[model samples]
Every structure is written in C-alpha cells, then in structure tokens.
Target: MTQVRFMNWYLKIAIGSAIIGGGMEFFMINTSFYDKVTVLEAEKGAYENSPQSQAMREALNPWRNKDTEATKTP
Candidate 1:
C-alpha cells in the first residue's frame, strides 16, 4: 500500500516561506560586516610589525590591552 502525504497545504506554505526567507538572508547582495573585517585583516597584514599597524589595531580594539605580538609573549 502507498503512504499518503503527511504535510498539508498550510505546512507546505509555511515551509516554503521559511525557505524563501532564509534564502533571501543567505543570498543577500549587500556586503556584510564580516567582509569589511576580512578586508581590515588583510590591511593589518599589509602593515605587519609596524607601529602604525599597532596603533590602528589599538584604535580598532580598545577593549584589549596588548597587541598580538606582545600578548603572544609570556
């Protein structure tokens, strides 16, 4: 015997709506905040081992006290 469909019309519509909503968010055309972060990280590497880079990092992350190199040390 064949089994009948468990999902009803409302359920399917709800699932479809949820999928489209999620897709809209996931496939957004806008550049995200993390994209800016990745670009800033690349810039950080561009200024490697420099006082300017240290100053920029400090200005960016004021909550943190020490720089990466300094924190890496004992």
Candidate 2:
C-alpha cells in the first residue's frame, strides 16, 4: 500500500513538472523574452563582429539612413 501511494505521488509530480516545463517553454518561445534574448545576442554579435550586425542594427536603429525624394512646394 505504501509503495503504491509513493508511486502515485511520483507520477503526479512527474506529470506536473512536465506540464509546467512545457508551458514555460511555450511562453519563452512565443513571448517577448525570446525576442529580448535574441536581440541581446544579436547586439553582442554586432559588437564582436561588424558585418554580421549591420542588417540587425539597421532594423533596430531609430534614425535610419534611407533617403526620401523631395516633395513639391505648396
């Protein structure tokens, strides 16, 4: 009887851990934390290597370099 109760407890804990882990993984991958980590990694990469970061920097930079054509005077 004791052995059976222990097994049940173990099974419940294992299942609960699995469910929580799955949820955490889903949240981490689908939420802003993932993007934040990716951005940090990209920034680190950009600091270590220039060429690898150029596109990422352009994508994140506020003051971009793209030119706009002149408009007609009103």
- Candidate 1 per-residue lDDT over residues 1-74, each given as its tens digit: 12335456667889999999987877654547568878899887878778887888789999785576687998
Cα miss at 4, model 1 (Å)?
12
Model 2: per-residue Cα lDDT over 1-74, one tens digit each: 99999999999999999999999999888887888998999888768677656767777874664433223332
The residue ranges of model 1 lying beyond 4 angstroms of the native Cα positions read: 1-7, 33-74
Q: Number of clashes in model 2?
A: 0
Q: Ten-residue segment with the worst summed lDDT in candidate 1?
A: 1-10
After TM-score superposition, what is the CA distance of residue 44 in candidate 2 from its true location, in Å?
2.5
lDDT, model 1, position 69: 65
In candidate 2, the residue pairs with backbone N, CA or C atoms under 3 Å apart (3 or more residues apart, or in different chains) clash, namely: none
lDDT of every predicted structure (CA atoms): 0.77, 0.81
TM-scores for all candidates: the values are: 0.31, 0.51
